[model samples]
Target: MTFVVGPVSVRTPASSANLGPGFDALGLALSLHDDLTAEVLESKGDERLEITVTGEGAEDVPRSGDHLVVRAMNATFDLLGERPAGLRLTCVNAIPHGRGLGSSAAAIVGGIVLARALVDGGADRLDDRAAFQLAVDLEGHPDNVAAAMFGGLTIAWIDGAAAEMQRLETTVETTVFVPPEAVSTERARGLLPETVPHRDAALNAGRAALLIAALTVAPEHLISATEDRIHQSYRAGAMPESYKLLRQLRVEGIPTIISGAGPTVLSFARGIAERAPQGWAVHELAVDVEGALVR
Candidate 1:
């Protein structure tokens, strides 16, 4: 297939995963976004990918084929059995990297959406399921990718090689306290025990179910709904400050959890300013209704 479209732009929202008890099953999309623009260049006989990045991680992110966004676009082209002639990509990113806020997922979704828009001639050819699967294939999980693609609250699960997701409505206000330092997802996962006790697993299962209901229907149960025994406690040693902050917030009767793999903490409480500790940047972000958008 010949590349026929002009310039295509895509915006994808940042995401938080786990939400305490759900552990790779639940995710929420935030208002923070990363914007990407892709234009098919008139072939100059140079096939090298060109990427210009501004905002977060601009100094470190790749400008070549190794870039995550470029890889995603290439994956889309491979999926369609067509090779991109040549392209120029511009990225304006706002989501912070490695703070448990789905920056990588946003990049992958943004690139896929950009490619889909260009290929479909401004139409959104990448539906929710297709986007979820493609992103999962790249990201190795569904939670963050699902939220970035579908927006709002997403319940994601993998079945064999396929991924599934359902979006849920949420009216709860949220506040995230991001520390200056970052803890890589790999480092945090390394802190978790290989096996959890059966009782803890059962307790977390109940809370996870309640959390879904509280976010969608029973908002009053949020305080109890956010309790977890799965990943958070096991990973507390990785980010002791974040863990301590979470404990303090819960003691004050607020529903809080380590946002994804953490170093950043998320609170379901609205008045978080008074509760937030020193040396943390607090952001009040709403649920992003439109996930990855092609414009």
Candidate 2:
């Protein structure tokens, strides 16, 4: 297959996974986005893989094939049985890296979608399902990728090693309190115990189920639905300030959750922007329904 003659761009929204009780299974796409643009270049050798970055993570992220976006694009092209001779990719990132905001997932989704859109008949060959599977494989989890790919709110799971997901529309309003310092998802996850009490598991399961309704038809149930008996409190020490803020907000009857892995707190209510802690940034955003789209 031939590459598209001109540059192709993709707009991929940021995702917040886990969404309280659903730990690694539920995700929501936020209005915040990252845009990636790429075009086939005619250069050779080192010049063949030029990349430019701006906005978040630009100064710290790798510029070579080690870059997550570049790797995802290469994987997509490999899956399509074709490879571009060269590439020039530009990333204008808006999502904060390592902030529990699914920045990595957005990069993965954007790269895959951008690559597919770059090849003629790529969409027909690598359909959404195939692209999604590739994305899940690359991300090592389906929750964030699923929401970033399908948009809205997604419940994702693995079946026989295959990624599966259900996307539902949600008009949930959210306000994210992002601390000045970021927390590593790996560090946060490492703090969790290998096992939990059966009663706690049961509570989480029930709340996860209720979360679906809370995000959709029953917004009032969000407070109860977003409660968790696992993960959050376990990893609280690593992000004490974040957890404290979560408790403060929840005590006030707001449905607040530690976005993704932690350090960024997401509340399912608006008009509370002034509640953010000192040195924290706040953004009010609605659910993004389009996922990743070519522009």
Q: Provide the overall lDDT of each model, using Cα atoms, as 2-decimal numbers.
A: 0.88, 0.94
Candidate 2 lDDT score at position 43 = 51
* Residue 47 lDDT (model 1): 70
Tens digits of per-residue lDDT, candidate 1, 125-192, equal 55656766888999998999999988999999988889998999997789999988889999999988
Model 2 lDDT tens row, 50-121: 899999999999999999999999999999988888899999999999899999999999999999999999
> Local error of candidate 2 at 117, Å?
0.7
TM-score of the candidate numbered 2? Answer: 0.98
Query: Candidate 2, residue 225: CA error in Å?
Result: 0.6
Model 1 alpha-carbon miss at residue 92, Å? 1.0
Model 2: runs farther than 4 Å from truth? 43-47
